[model samples]
Target: MTGYALRKGLTFCRVDGRFVFLDLPRDRYFCLSPIADQAFLDVIAGESPAWVAAALRDGLLRETADDTRPVACIPPAPPRGSLHDNNQIVSRTSVLGALTRRAASRVWLRARPLKAVLDRVQERKSSRAGVELSVAQISRLAASYRRAGMLVSAHDQCLATSLAVAWQLASLGATPHLILGVKLHPFQAHCWVQLGDVVVNDQLDAVRLFTPILVV
Candidate 1:
């Protein structure tokens, strides 16, 4: 009898036969109970389910126009079967440049709203036309960022490092996809950069462990 969409600011994804949601502002992922997941499935399947009221109470879905169709936000999947390159000779200049970008990413994340910062990423991804990077060049960019990430004092958090990598590649004319992935068993979230099927920021073996939920 009704239609719905993801709650404002939430991105919807389906991973491993389950519904997954990313709340960027809250910096968390939301998975549904089996009943709610089935309700959402039915809703998106274009059926009006009586059970949707239960999902509404849970706050992940909101009312939409009756005719609106809710669809999953499908991001390009990381090339899990491909190996991540780490062979480039990293230079001090590359390290410095990446660190500078990383600092900027950190500051922007702290000073500006997360949506505003992500808006910049979206802007770069959309507006920067005519920029093309070859496979080798992309690998070099990833290598530089990986080396720079190693030197940072912060423990192994991936957000800032991944953002810097995406920003650097974009500045160099490569519009990179900054991917947000999650896994459920132990519950983990990770971020990485990719161009098409080539995963630039992390190893495929490690990258395969998570399913991409959002890409920006």
Candidate 2:
């Protein structure tokens, strides 16, 4: 009997008694049936595929030849920008804008649905035509977010920071890319905002450490 293993980079969360799987590489999510969920759990516990096959009569736990290879989901590279620029001038208006965006982002991250937030981000990105913000402008926006304490005090960490940054950028008629990445071995997950290849909310060196699972 061939051996089987749970696919790598597959993270799951339980919602309403059902297991919702997040296929990180593909950026797809789906709920598993009770039987399939059980099989998956068993495989994750290091049980042999033959043992799992006994319970899953439909052969849902069949072994695959390429079990160790990592999945890739790279998107077309966007235009790159400089990592460093002159500090943005902090004005009363910029401060007020950051505060408003931070408050809104906090509420949206908590009260709104994940799909809804993603949809809105996509809509904003698509709606903006040829209006791209320069590196200095993005830097200034990020600085405003920092001054408003949006980046440091967010309870949701990277998610909140990314959302706040994206929101602020969108309001300024600049589209920013939201990226989700995962690191193996230690199993770390991070989200950040970017404009083209330029890291917006976080340092580029830090983001380069993880493999991007989703870019939007």
Candidate 3:
């Protein structure tokens, strides 16, 4: 019955590490591998309106592969001109100080499973000390996501990996953001996790490589 329902609904399924088409909600049937089915089930079971939005965004990105498109390169800022003389005073101060602070708190409050995952990932990936993510402790995944995106855009790297990481963060109950920027050369936007001025996964090179721009 479950299989039949999934097939009729035109839903997606994972089977044997492959994606399968299921014509769900129409009494039709399509089959997928056990792994795909399980993953699909997990996603479904964990479904929430919030997650739905994220999934849609991710789906759209995947469908068109826009996230993979190269970001335009931005030229270096010319020395501050007379126009900036006055504005520079304020810009130099706290540009997004409030937003950053709010975001940091939000990530710490909402993030789940981030610390554990980070620990596991670190254990497996690194042997160096000082390579730990600064905000791994806080539950502020959304804030982290935003920060990560900004870092990636500034660095110019792959966005897909960042998206994957963001998705993982959202699943853990963190609010993430997608950041876009062009500096020096063309690159993809990305996401990050944060905790009170500390960056989670800062030591992970994945931040430099993946461009996760949006939290959803």
Candidate 4:
């Protein structure tokens, strides 16, 4: 009765009622058939590898005599910035700037190739001046985008929100890290922007549930 476990650097998410596996180290993704998905879930939940192998009459899971790798690590939080009051008034200039960048982000996502878009974002991060925004300022910028209908009905909300926030931060001369993360079990993927480890555009608790697969 050999025990089985998910491989290191591997995560899965259920998208549109199907299980999708991500091998992070290999940068590959695989969609699992329903039977395989159930087998995987059973194995990871402490079923014997040999039992699953016999049941399927095949090698379904990797046998692990000893598994040592940590499945996830939470990044250290960044130094705290000044907290902003929810009622703080946002300046017109900041609101307009965020809206403009959000529009540009939507257009770039639609028109450009993904690699090209990522490269352009990387360039912005590298060339950004050292200016930093307060938590209040960042919150205000995100609010402005939401209020302006920039993110309304976005097909990929995480991608759209991350891009919009990244652009808004860059416009303010701050370099932001765009992050992509995955969580197994219930299986989900999420994206967000951060300054250091401080999540700029999403709830810290929410982002903490995911294991970061990419930080751009």
Candidate 5:
């Protein structure tokens, strides 16, 4: 928390010398103008920049008691050398179970607000004392999910699928990160699950296309 920090439910990080913001409350992503970006940096640095007052008026920044949160902070993206893929044999029964679980997740997501859904996921993730899953185990889980994913009807099933996968692995005592990411230019949002650097429910190359804005 800086003297002036991002409002609650808002977070941002730097990418390619620009600040990318994720507005969780609105469920949207955006980039600050170069001037606003520099102003934010200055505000965090304890020297109010020219646009600080305007940013405050705009509700982008709020008064903070004591500074702690960094301007840009989040988990590292999957490493280039990380284990990206693995061979696995998924049983028909497993795929069916995955389909059923993912469907439930989709229904749950549809019934709740975006922030509420993400909040519930974070609550569960914090409650569970999950273990580190082995690469082979992760592979099996991912493969089964992928097989079931083929049957999913929606193109925007990434959030539901990743949420279900993260919840599933957490129940098994495996700690998996549910990552929410965004990409600019065309402006897209995506979600995926991973264990350390190993992607759990999506391809590394695919997820790498977006920069992680939140890690739950």
Candidate 6:
């Protein structure tokens, strides 16, 4: 694995009292609470991971919000050859368009003000039963759609689509279960989202494509 500092276009910040960084041109993101962030910085600064891990896992903030994540520095661009011919034949199943549509759909679906569904689901489980859809799931689906979207000339790989999905779902009072991964290849590292055992809306078979850093 490449050293954290060696990672290109890497930017860090303190968010919601947590230390976090967003890797650009690639789609990966990472976070740490105040204490945890210190540890990671320490590790990047030459601190030992063994000791840092011990301290981090002992007692610290367990969860971080999506909106609180570090910002993306480098935005995405259109695929190569997008402006080549005068054909102007647009594809409907583009990756970017699909992600946008899926993310928007989740937001619209949640705004129905359907208290009956919430009431019934909570009655069956707990107050949090069906309050919201999983952010991880949405991210995955958006990714899949984006892949299709890209193929159909609808859109290209834009990291913000995943961020939008995460933000929208969180705003709807939905449960957030996100597992993020970055594919650090020769060209760039791309990010992907995952839920329990499923890769949501994966454009390609994520299992066959990405190498996971953490499964969440």
Backbone clashes for every candidate come to 0, 0, 41, 0, 4, 16
Best candidate according to TM-score: 5
Model 3 TM: 0.21
TM-score for candidate 4, residues paired by index:
0.56
**TM agreement with the true structure for every prediction:** 0.85, 0.61, 0.21, 0.56, 0.87, 0.32
Query: What TM-score does candidate 5 reach?
Result: 0.87
CA lDDT scores, all candidates in order = 0.75, 0.62, 0.33, 0.61, 0.77, 0.39
Of candidate 6, the 10-residue stretch with the lowest lDDT total is: 76-85
* Model 3 agreement with the true structure over 142-173: per-residue lDDT tens digits: 33434544543424332333334433444444
Residue 11, model 1, lDDT: 83
In the range 12-45, model 6's lDDT, one tens digit per residue, is 4443344445443343465555565666655645
Q: Report how far residue 188 has shifted in candidate 4, in Å.
A: 2.4
- Which pairs, if any, clash in model 1? none
| Model 1 agreement with the true structure over 33-113: per-residue lDDT tens digits | 888788788888888788767667867668886766577777784484332456788789987887888788788778877
**Which residue pairs in candidate 2 collide?**
none
Q: Determine the backbone clash count of candidate 5.
A: 4
Per-residue error for 189 in candidate 2, Å, reads 1.4
Tens-place lDDT per residue, model 4, 57-139, is 54324555564222222334542432112344666676676567666777887887655676678788778858877776777
Q: Give lDDT for model 5.
A: 0.77
TM-score of 1: 0.85
Where is model 2 more than 4 Å wrong at Cα?
1-71, 75-86, 150-156
* lDDT score at residue 39, model 4, on the 0-100 scale: 61
Off by over 4 Å in 3: 1-157, 185-198, 201-216
Better of 5 and 6 by lDDT: 5
**Angstrom error at residue 55, model 5:** 1.6
The best candidate by lDDT is 5
